[model samples]
Target: MTAIDTPNGMAEGTLDGSMAEFFKAQTRSSAPVMVNVRTLKRFPTAGCARLEATLIQDGVPTQQGSAIPFVIRYEINLCRDGRPPTEGIDLDAASRVLPR
Candidate 1:
């Protein structure tokens, strides 16, 4: 099982399996409607492996239009075996997707 280490605490299991705990700990208001999960890159060091991914969430809506879902952008990092310690796992950064 994959372990999700958040600033609040840690959750152990696959993403789907840990949905309840994740929402309780990380989100506010509504639950995530969609998660566009994609890996950006991978780094393998001596003792641990590092993974970078781009996550987009479609859940909370914009103030202007409630019907249109707000797209949230996030960059996440996952560390294996906790080697470096500097680079930890979980939601690293989050921001609203700007319009074009």
Candidate 2:
């Protein structure tokens, strides 16, 4: 599934033209971003899991300086009925900005 977290909100599944524009408008520059997994937990039910991670954007440009950095904390819920060859995995994600 295609999932992306934008500054305005989260965009999931097949993105449309408007969503693409929103992403471009929100993220004007191509800043290097990295996803760092903080925790992973599996549910009692098979093929179910949850992940918590942070998206780090380093060396962001700002009016005061050009080295500003920020982090966005997010959680992803994933589940699948069978293996990849036969089944598909579903993903749902949400995110929030962490205070600097």
Candidate 3:
């Protein structure tokens, strides 16, 4: 139930997106052709967790379209007990990103 959107870590990039949301406690989220993200594990002293995901430009993009997939990584800082897995991500009118 991990939530994923944009590329987590990258320098000088842009998210041509409109709006989205994610839960802090949510993990193991996925998407069919959007992007794949998930949490590996947790630690006691860790206020932040690790998420691994991939973003791909699937075909569904043009009249006669072709696209390729991309790989991205995320190191998110989430508060414990903040947002549960079944909770709804409010997006705040945007998407959840993990770029550094």
Candidate 4:
């Protein structure tokens, strides 16, 4: 399996600001956190890359706002990586990625 690029035109296995935000939201809490990204493919796969948020608060990350904490909102986006040019990751939708 190949690495996927961020929704934006980033190199394969890279995350943009929006992607970081999505990860934070998924984990919940505006406080900053880090994300380790790997392809949801194959068996016993290797991790692709790890992304750190630009800022952190109380061990959680806050947006790199201008002298203020930014509200964690969905207006943010997640860069999707795939072997080929795929649509993107739908965090709101569940992926049938695991065996039932």
Best by TM-score: 2
**Model 2: residues >4 Å from true position, as ranges?**
1-27, 80-100
Query: How many angstroms is residue 20 displaced in model 1 relative to the true structure, after the best TM-score fit?
Result: 6.7
Local distance difference test, each candidate: 0.39, 0.46, 0.37, 0.37
Residues 15-42, model 4: lDDT tens digits: 3488667856754545554323333332
Per-residue C-alpha lDDT of model 3 across residues 20-87, encoded as one tens digit per residue? 12321121122233455555444344333444544433222323454333344555434345543322
Task: Give the candidate order by descending TM-score.
Answer: 2, 1, 3, 4
Q: Point out the worst 10-residue segment of candidate 4 by lDDT.
A: 71-80
What tens-digit string does per-residue lDDT give for candidate 2 at 1-100? Answer: 1121223232323223654445434545345455455325555555554556565555556677555675667776655543222123233221234233
Evaluate residue 44 in candidate 1 and report its C-alpha lDDT on the 0 to 100 scale: 47
Model 1, position 73: C-alpha lDDT score: 54
TM-score for candidate 3 = 0.31
Q: How far off is residue 52 in model 2, in Å?
A: 0.5
Worst lDDT window (10 residues) for model 1?
1-10
lDDT value, residue 75 of candidate 4 = 16
TM-score of 1: 0.35
Model 1 residue runs over 4 Å out of place are: 1-32, 46-65, 81-100
lDDT accuracy of residue 72 in candidate 1: 46
7, model 2: CA deviation in Å? 32
Candidate 1: pairs in clash: none
> What does candidate 1's lDDT look like per residue over 1-100, in tens digits?
0323233222322234466446434544245434444333444442233333233333544566453443445545545564333434232441234333
